[model samples]
Target: MDARRDAAEDGRETIGISWSSPTRPARRDRRQRPCAVDPVMEIEIVHLDRRHAGLRIADPARLAHLVGSLARHGQQSPVLLVKVEDRTVLVDGYLRVTALTDLGRDLVDAVVLDHVDEVGALLLRHRLQARRSTALEDGWLLIELLEVHHRTQADLATVLQKSTSWVSRRLALARALPALVQEAVRVGSMPPHAAMKFLVPLARANAADCEAVVVALGHQRVTTREIERLYLAWRRGDPEQRARIISNPRLFLKVEAELEVPPVAPDETSALVDDLEGVAGLCRRARKRLRTGVLERASASERAPVAAAWRETREALRTLAARMDAEEFDGRPRDTHRDPAAGQRRPQPSPDREDVEGVTEHRQEDPRGANTRGPTLRSGIEAPAPSDADP
Candidate 1:
């Protein structure tokens, strides 16, 4: 059956339909008929009367596409609006109103709801229609509904046609994430899930560190795995490790190596081999001392410089290791001739018991200024001090 014929047969008149002429302003039909089931009191109103107060974010491409569709085929659905004093605030169909305005249509079809407040309007919009809203947007809306409007999660679930758990999650996300992180998600700097995965845990554990990392790495294009790795490292690493990661992320991220080894001649290779051996021996002695708890007894002032140097050396080793791994994967040999520590002399050995006793006697005699030699170790063993003219 035709719509008009069916309406007539049901003893009701379709008084909502109206038209505007180019020569004159459009007016609403005065004839009003009551609808039984879906009673939508649609009328023609000025496009300017509508005001958007919903949760949908503005998207230009979507609006442009909507405008094209509306221009080809006029607005098929009426936007829901609620009367506020003399103004009509939009409850839904924001895209339609925007499209109508772009097409220079002075009049738009609207269903003017009666006595609905802002909260009611939002609830009605959610209940009557389904729209795509970002998680951040959902969070903001959920916050407003709960905090500003004093609505409960159950109420939100009922109104938005979502589960109670869904509403709870949205509310929690809104409350837990900082405004900056929310803004990052809203501004498309990162995905919502990624922010929840990467930023939330850090922010919960240490907000300052999270903020620092965000400011440092937010602009960089990092993958989810990289972000997770960085988060884990920042959360558990020592001061030096954290500082190194923050200062030189490219190294941890496996970008370009800071130091490159160039091909070396046979003579340079011999020197490089000796330098590597010296470093290995130094590391062995340091490990032995650490195992013996020697550093644990050191004063803070003495340990500070040692810790700093250790961190620096650790970063250098990491960079070198990454470079070696990359070269190995590419089936290329690294050049050992261009060693970073090239030409530097091997460390002098530590003083023996006799030499130490002599140094102690000298210090006792001249406490003001004693020219005592510093100690060193070789391959987990203490060595005697070198003579001044040994070189």
Candidate 2:
């Protein structure tokens, strides 16, 4: 038997053994025979290499925490790596490697896989183990596996330990959102579901408009409902309306109103009209008083308390306006209109006599309608009838 010691200057050591027999062939012992071992299953120290596909984007705060944990307890989990022709690529455990590197470690423990499929499966396993993967991360991984690797969704689903539907949804979300929107989601500017729900449909319907809206509101953290409404308004509105909605969405959403006018007896028509005019005058007076007494005087320090009071009043009015827009008032569908320039209230178009009579008849039939307020004028006075030859 001959034994040799091979030592590298870097302190790495290797041992080799050989036996020579004369006259008789050496019989190998069954127990000592070399058994095939998967290199992917073995954990060994390796040089950290980052030039590889990974789903996780390193977070500074999380990396800091990992650095601290590693400094105290050392690396509890081995990172996964894939061996290519001449280089090793990272598959998972980016944070661990990053922490270890920051700690001035020369080597990292890794499980190196030979095949790309095994690499993908282990990537997903590590992702699940970390439990920090976002939908966008899943989306990116799904795309890599399906498009780049040419893998089926079923195969990925099995590898990811998720339902086929889950894989499909992630892929669909990735495909539906534009690259800009995806970046916005990735950087925490836009939420994943918001991008998937609002921007995806907008992109499908009109890519230019979707891009425009994203460019406009990408910096703001908009809610899902706000995004939905903004998309709807953009889809249905003209250029000016779209701009208005994007700039002041809450104002646009709150400006909608439905108005219905009921018919009165021909003899009582004049009186009903006069009462509406009176109500309109009262509202105009109240608005004028509020504008002059509170808003105009708001700059004065003496009026600070009054300004605070006005804020409460304004909120209450907004609540009332929203409620009024939603429900009918005075036994009629409430007539509401908003002047785009000033955001002021305007009356809805008056119902025709026939429609008014229909509502009147319904009100008589339903006793509950009697308890509600009578048809209220939304806007004060009617516009003058157009002259027959005006055109």
Candidate 3:
């Protein structure tokens, strides 16, 4: 008997099953007798073992959990089964039915269909059905079902899941990972959840560099931040930056040496005593002289050029500091975003420190007159008070 006919006889295939819109009901003959049972409403257990189940049952935990639930409350749904000679086979519901058995339910409720195709049409039909329905991560659903079916390399088309070749192609990306990276993933050192997110981008950019970073990270005990640092360095850091480490073999060796070597102790006794006595004598003489000789020599040396340069630098720094403070007070700030070309510099106190006393009225003249293109404007200069005269 045809499966369609069997489905119709069992009432499992309702009149409006296929189409989105309902079809008109057939006019019943007046002589037709009413049946005792509504076939569609009844749940019966049919043994269907010969059918090839290709959907993966990979997550055993989930399966066990479902089984536990089923144990508490018997199989609420019937599995679709088709008769094949002496044996009835499962057409769908692989995991759910497995859960039923695991839950210790000896029998399953099933709808009996007449024919069982030698090749599983269920797998193809399911994929086609899924394809029409929604999007998914690359072969994720099919892969899961294959695992459930325990058919890793089975012909997917016949199994109605995925072809063996297709599974191989998709698996290779993950399977071909470096042993060290794989180990890291397995050990929970690298988050398995984010491994793919890290892997795909790295592998696409430079497989060798990706492998190097992974291996390098594995050797040292590293934190997630360090791993992220290395991973991102490869992603966005320039080629020169990557080459600085990779090209220099000695750097790694230097790190190793630092790790292996112990600290050195300072020479004691004579060195300590001689250094202390000499320091004490110099200190006493320097204190007695009050560094007058050093000062006399410094002044006598006609260091006008050096003095002028120092004075100018000090004044410029002071002006800058004043400007910065003014900007801060006014709520207008300078640029803070990093500029690669500008590089980094240590901050110095501005030259405006002494100017705060208001001795010079023209202090607003940018102390660095030549640094900017604009002409410097001079304000009125104020004389020092007689008591506050310069020394």
Clashes of each: 1, 5, 22
RMSD values, in order shown: 22.2, 23.5, 22.0
Candidate 3 regions with alpha-carbon error over 4 angstroms: 1-46, 50-55, 113-120, 128-351, 354-391
Candidate 1 local lDDT, residue 27: 52
lDDT (C-alpha, whole model) for all candidates: 0.57, 0.54, 0.45
Point out the worst 10-residue segment of candidate 1 by lDDT: 354-363
- Model 2 alpha-carbon drift over 4 Å, by segment: 1-54, 57-61, 71-74, 98-109, 113-128, 132-135, 157-165, 217-237, 244-391
User: Order of all candidates by TM-score, from best down to worst?
Assistant: 2, 1, 3
RMSD of 2: 23.5
Q: TM-scores across all candidates?
A: 0.43, 0.43, 0.30
- The positional error of residue 302 in candidate 2, measured at the CA in angstroms, is 68
What order do candidates take by lDDT, descending?
Answer: 1, 2, 3
Q: Which tens-of-lDDT digit does each residue in 197-219 have in candidate 2?
A: 77888888777667766777747
Candidate 1: where is the Cα deviation over 4 Å? 1-54, 57-78, 85-87, 95-110, 132-136, 157-166, 215-233, 240-391
